[model samples]
Target: MSETKISKLFTELNQLKWSVVSKGVIVGLFAGFVVALYRLGIEFATEKSIEIYEFLKHNQEYIIVWIVVIVVVGLLIAWLIKCSPESKGSGIPQVEGVVLMGMKMRSFFIIPVRFIAGILSAFFGVSLGREGPSIQIGACGGDIIASKLSHNKLEENYLITAGASAGLAAAFNAPLSGIIFALEEIHRSFSPNILLAATTAALTADVVSKTIFGLKPVLSYVDIPALPLSQYGWLLLLGILTGVVGALVNKFVLVSSKVYDVLPAWSRPMVALLLALPFGLFLPQVLGGGQNLVQLSETAQMTVGVLFVVFIAKLFFTTSSFGSGIPGGIFMPILSMGAIVGSIFAQTLSGFGIPASSIAILCICSMAGVMAGSVKAPITSILLMAEMTGSLVHLLPVAAVAFIALLTSDLLGIHPIYEVLLERLVDKDHVNKKHDNIVLEIVVEMGSDVAGKKVSEVNWPTGTLIAGIRRGQKEYVPNGDFIIYHGDYLIVLSSEHELETMNTCLNKLCRKN
Candidate 1:
């Protein structure tokens, strides 16, 4: 209790914090290397697959061979998912389960299975992104290290989050977004420990990625001029459009999952793969992750009509591919669709006296808007777009659009895409329930039901206990009199048996009414 004693205690705690972050850096380094390798593998497989498609296009005689190859690849992907169910889909939900729901994943099995299956899915032209798999791979790497070196569950979770941060950072070469995403979306809190660890991990992983992929932004659009104040009205309109589209995309993704559920597990991928055949042969621009499609749109290679066709095709293909429960991600696919939407919107307004350069700016801003609407992470969307485009000149416009899109989506009562997916996965009990003690960190969104309520006012679940509350740099042991505000993080502790009920109650309390 003395001044010297308190100073010594603070110093020790600071040292301890840095030590954990140091471990995170080490985990991040390993995760970065693994994700880099995964990226290279996917790139190689994608190139080879495209080459095969080109060759087959020229030689109709080999069409039968290509069909057989796709079927076999489909079967292989199905088998991989069967062997390691944890590797299914984007793996982001599973990571969320691990960190928040006390879900367990077999790192040894999931790591390789996801890597191989993800590459194969991409190779076969499944409309998927590499970012999700990279995140899972990074999380697995962290899990492996934590299991070997740390026995504490809290520390292990931090490492897992760190790995996920590293994964996204390495995948997109956006360290800041990666860090913000891990906090704003994954952890859903601003814990000092999590921030430090995630930052170290993301930066370290970015270093590894840049060493191999160079220092260029992921989606480079140089010389993007800032939108004038007069054009602000158009940006708002674009935001509303993207918000509606994002909600529809979210609905279709869930609906597609249900549609695919009727089929036998092994047949789902086969059907989706077969569905890809026609598009692959006729409209290859919408294939794979569709990054090139976005680049093409940016260069105005496609007219409005053609952009619409490609958008519909990519949207449906992405929904189907994800619904089939393959080892893939919707991150890039969603972004690609957003780009197409932006292009179409820009082209439509070109006759209204909007300059070509302004159209391009609208296209760029809409991408962020759609992302924010769908993912419900406006900060991440804005920062990610800024990093991807390598220009912050349009930050105000991007932020405005992202905020509007998020508001629109919320008004429509559409849950964030990942949150919905996580719910589905959790309902199926994909997570291992061996751990009885579970800790959940829930963020209070600005307009959430509990945002301005006192601790005692909210109808918390019977068995749930508020372990602590964190608001910015301050922490508190919540009492009945304590008032919770927007941006405060509630640390709730509950048993596994009570998790579902607790989550239901928490959702009602936290979600925007």
Candidate 2:
């Protein structure tokens, strides 16, 4: 190429790079403030919820008023769901659907709806977490900004991803985990553009969160001692136990919807609130997102029997509450359950002369293990747990447990929770929709039906056109003689009438042979 041509090309590339970085800053700042506000709201709601319960406990006459309040909160949640169905449940799957599939969300309505519903649901003592809603809110902020500033769909996707990472970072004060999650789980690639945007946004958001919530870790563990090599065996055993329990948790959560499907739409959320009354009055420790339960386990205040009971109650309640299609997340609840499991395991070993300090280590490791097994994001889980505890002294144990739990879940043929949830959402919302012209992106899995096949050999669905194929950082137009390889991202275009049929065919074509 000529010198002038090369210079012009480099100039354009530099401009694009700076443009994306600038946009990332804007997204990070906006999403950071929004999520920070969300965090404050959640804190207020949680404190008020406990205060109300305490008041009722002291005054028997006010019990009726509490019941009336719960019923009203339930109706309001049900109404919110009715008005914005997309805001129901943990917002992670919805964000994933938007990024992976070509699904669209009405950000203006979803943001406020999710914020209000999430706070109210938790305020009424529902077993939900605030992180999920914060993520959705951040993504919506990114989308709104990108929609107004940029015209390219590809650029918009990057901003949305950056927003998601920023949201998670602000929610938990874990910037690295947020960036890794965006790349590993959300984008499923290590593209340079995504890396740059995610890093910038996550760090910026972390700063904003720290400014408001201080520099302390979200779940602080003071002076956590490292485990000895001799005690590593126990971590493996704990991993296996957490793996089994994690699989069960995923299974129950998936079927919770089916269990509640028989109920009227408006009454679904109400059932969870009504059931919460008994637990709220009797065993309030298992209420909300179970943060207090984690504190109790960490301090070893609860006996083994009491820990087991709390675990069982939390497991059942979380599944039921989530199944009601309320605006909440299982992220914190799952971690809390893992803490209980670890406590029980440690207590069982204490009979055999295990040190209490080592048991505390197991509690932390098991939290990472169960999160890895259920979410199938081992790196994110490990980093998140470490960051939350403000210690990397247990990376080896954490990694070992996380790997084992992830393997066990895979052996059981279980999909990641978010993946399953996204599939269900798509099945319900997109299977019957018709579009004028739509583009679909499919990653060619190893051993997929079309892997290693020439363009002429594979039978593609009718009325669909292969627009392009992306391999590594390059894009190419395929010809009859071109061969498709595994890991290639195929961009297919179809008419409105053939959208659903094309989607099914493409999904099958992308599945493992």
Candidate 3:
């Protein structure tokens, strides 16, 4: 109660916080190993898949073989989901559930399965992004560490945040952006503890990934130049246009998902197959990561019509793949689509006699603008774009467009895709539930004897009983007889003193379970 006493208490608390962060650094280093290997596997699969595609392109005899390969990849994805439902979509929403809603789901099997399956799907020409799955997988590593290394709830959460940041950093070789992403998007909070854990994780992940793959930016040699002062007007115009397109894309994706659901479950794959064939035949540039299109735009070689067609095709495929509930991500597709559209906008100016250098600058800004509009993370998008392209020269134009595009998108009622996806992942009825005052969140770990036990068998401490369980999409109001499963989120409610005793009892029960 005295000033000296308060100061001593504060010092002890600070020491405790740093100790947790030190443990986080160890967890992050461990998680980085998984992330580095995961990225390596993706690159290897991508290389082999391209080789097969080249072989099929030249050999008429191999055309049927290509069809078989494509069909097999589709069936494999369908089968993986059919068997283990957790491997669906970008793993972002699931990770968010684990952190925010007390949903328990482990990555022990799911992460590796996703790495193999996602790489296969992408390599075999299934339209997807590698980063989203990789990030989710990386976060799983953190979740694993959190559960294994500590029974402290705060410590576990910090580790989870760290692991997720490491995964993103490893995937893109952008350590700073990954840390920002964990703070801005994943944790949705900023504190000294969270910052320390996330920084350690991201920095560690990048170091590991770079050691394995070399310290190169994901997209190479993008000569982003500064636009003339007069060109600022066009950049603003580009941002407004991107806002409209982003809104439209969101609409189409939501509609497509609804339509896909209306179809019979078995019939969904056939629809995706049909969509892929036509797009594959006519616009191969829009296929895969669309890295080629990005390269073309940087070189200022794509014509306006070509860029427009690529944009349309990319949008359609992205809608089809994501809407049909394919196990993939939109990060790359959305960014690539925006880049193509931006290229066309810049090309239009070139036709109007805008200088070539100015057009290039505008093109880069347009990419950042649309990505900011679509994701609704303007600062993150700008930093990611600048990092990805390895250029800070266009920061002013990028900022101008990103601000306008983000503002316009908000006016049109657009939400970030991950936020929207999380909402959709939760059942509508659950959203309407009012949990205004009652809840307790706890993280479970491997060594906790509770790791493999049922709720009914474990004796809870006095004044505490499990009220509900949330594992991934599933939630339950537990009866006294229910069992607690691993990665199962136990929602317990109690008073301050009861909670304290309950926490100690839970820890002891965890030791014995």
Candidate with best TM-score? 1
lDDT of 2 by residue, 1-513 (tens): 344653453344335445667888888898899999988888788778787777777787988887787778888889988888878888888888766664677789888888888888777687878777778888888789888987655567778888999989998899999899897777665656677888888888899899989999888775778888878878778888888888988999988888887898888888988887777777889888877877778778899999988898999889999999898889889999988988888888987766888766788888888888899999999999889878788899988999999998889888899899888888778312323465455678888899999988999888778877778766667788899999887867667576656877887887684
Encode model 1's per-residue lDDT on 43-134: one tens digit a residue.
Answer: 88777767777777889998888778878888888898988988999898888877766778899999899888888777778898999888
What lDDT score belongs to each candidate, Candidate 1 first? Answer: 0.83, 0.81, 0.69
| Candidate 1, residue 26: lDDT | 90
Question: Candidates' TM-scores?
Answer: 0.90, 0.89, 0.79
Top candidate, metric lDDT: 1
Among all windows of 10 consecutive residues in model 3, the one with the lowest summed lDDT is: 429-438
Estimate the lDDT of model 1. 0.83
- How many residue pairs collide in each prediction? 0, 0, 6
Better of 1 and 2 by lDDT: 1
lDDT of 3 by residue, 1-513 (tens): 344653453354355467667776776677677777776776676566566656656666866766776677667666766555556677776666555554455578668678766776666555667777777777788878866776655566667777788888887888888888887777654546677888888887788878888878887745556777766667767889888777777777787788888986545644565476545555566667666667777677878887777787788888887776666777777777777777788777776666767655665676777777877777777888778867787787888888898888999999887778777776532221112222354545456766666666666677775655656555566665666655565656655444434644665554334
Model 1 residue 162 CA deviation (Å) reads 1.3
